[model samples]
Target: MQESISVCHNQYILKPQSIESEELENATFHAKQRAIEARQTISPWKKSHSLYETGGWKSLFENINQPLNLSTQSKEFQTRYNESANSLEQVVESAKLPLCPSGQPEIGNTVVFGVVGGTVEAPSIAYLTESQPVTEEILALSDSVKPTEIFRIASSCQADACRHFDGANCRLAVRIVQQLPTVVETLPACQIRSSCRWWQQEGKAACYRCPQMVTDNGYSSKILQEVGDPYSK
Candidate 1:
């Protein structure tokens, strides 16, 4: 016989009433703790850069105040150093933080909105980036047209204004996990997962229902209505 312990979505089996099993459980628990600590140690800012370049606050200071060799210090050298420092600062400032698509838009970088289609067997959608600009006519019509009717608006996450935010974790995400039916067991191939607030917060559980989520008015599905409206009491 074996005993099992659940860890979030995963379960680990242990031999029944055995000292080895107890030690194993303890080791497993400690390993998970160490993994969490390691993850937290790595700053979220580092993930923004594709090249893994150090563009954090500390690096910014170092770039600005690096000691210059007097013998090699020329007018051209100073100008180049200033330019390099400016470029580094811009990179740090411009790094786009992950946002919740269902939340509010913070930046006007690009709208990655899309419509969820296909069947339960297979869902289909496309992310609309800056390259594919929505025409002025469409933009004008969007005011009258409901977003869910046409496309799911994948905007920036406003963690501050969100009702689910309890000064720390997102309660809405937890609610979504409880209320919504899991459509898929595995995580969907999402372009915005790297910078998605839901994925970051709720992990793969969020992705299970993310594809079918609609934020338009007059949703027929009760589950959709509740999950879509974060402010709904």
Candidate 2:
């Protein structure tokens, strides 16, 4: 299952590249131009859920660098590396995006493309790199994190397309992976599951263009795929 998820991530990550290439091939000027602009900002480590840092790596490096360890003297480098990684994760995840260039969520969040695991280019920076994934610290961060209001915000934002239909159920996926501010809770069962555009259009995809993700742990191919392919939409 893990391999399948990773493979799924790889496929979705590459989809944008294929779409961008097709845009250029067909001479769709606007798409080609947009693709170019989008390409300029893509970053590999920007979107991966598995590549974040909160507290796990910090603990590991610190443990290894403990004064009681014989290798502590040489292991100081690990501490610096962990620190740098953590900082990078913070920058990539916390940057606010302009929905209308004025910085408001009412208009919606902007998504950047990202390329994970190859020389392939992306239209934005919402994917991962070949060598990036959550370190122990990142996983620890995931553990401590809670779901965000955007889950509901996004839910309410597109209330029309949601499947939790009895009028307020977020019924699409039995599990909506989000970082809320408290314990990992199964949000109200989505009654609009089938009607949701994300499920209907993206199918098992996460929405990375969401503000919650942008303000939290970076973007990922898994999320973008849910937004649907640009050409198709």
Candidate 3:
């Protein structure tokens, strides 16, 4: 099984070992911080998902006219948001991809589609019906354990910016569909299936095998650990 990429609590693990000098290490750290800040400023996931979680297309265009907080701060907000998000399960949504091996780009925009449960020796994933946006507060509930070990998160596809993505396609998604075996006979309920890159590229086969996908599966089955390799292809 391939070793999981090393990470420092909720931080992006971008080729950390290559820096041989203190000056170079400082430069790399600063560059990463800048890149993260820039991404947060410009990433469409933040702007788009904010509108999406509030309602849908209606809220998107309508919220521009009304105050932004109206959708999120009012009564029936949670109910309406969940209903709106789940309704997309029927209609095909825009493409979103899996959380990267390094780490999630922005947890504020990341959605929890599946829950990793069972034990370390025998981990299993259960898909969720409603989209659940992750918050910093929610992640704190896990304490010492990595949240990726307990959740299958989906976020906006980073394309060339992600290591698993080749110039044209997502190699990790491809590897998953090709190397991972189907664990479920029936199509599992998914919060992001309509927008999932795996589902869009691999179709029902991805969903069939999705129950076994663990993002930070250091303790997962040997087969899963192998499939999790970002550079396998």
* Top-scoring candidate (lDDT): 3
Which candidate number would show the highest TM-score if scored against the true structure?
3
Predicted structure 2: lDDT = 0.26
Go through the candidates in order and give the C-alpha RMSD of each one to the true structure: 21.0, 18.8, 15.5
Regions more than 4 Å wrong, model 1: 1-97, 103-107, 118-144, 228-233
Measured with C-alpha atoms, the lDDT of residue 109 in candidate 3 is: 46
lDDT of 1 by residue, 122-199 (tens): 222333332122233333333333323334445444333345566566666776777766654555545567777678
Give the TM-scores of the predictions, in the order they appear: 0.46, 0.18, 0.54
Question: On a 0 to 1 TM-score scale, where does candidate 1 land against the true structure?
Answer: 0.46
Residue 193 lDDT, candidate 3, scale 0-100: 72
State the lDDT at 144 in candidate 3. 46
Q: Per-residue lDDT tens digits of candidate 2, residues 1-233?
A: 00111133233222222123222213223223433333454546443221112212223333442222223422463344445554665434423311111011111221212211122222222122121121232222222231110112121122222122223323222123332111112221222334334444334343432211221222334443332111112
lDDT of 1: 0.40
| Candidate 3 residue lDDT tens string, 75-142 | 33334444545456422332344433223313224665555543333334545556456665545533
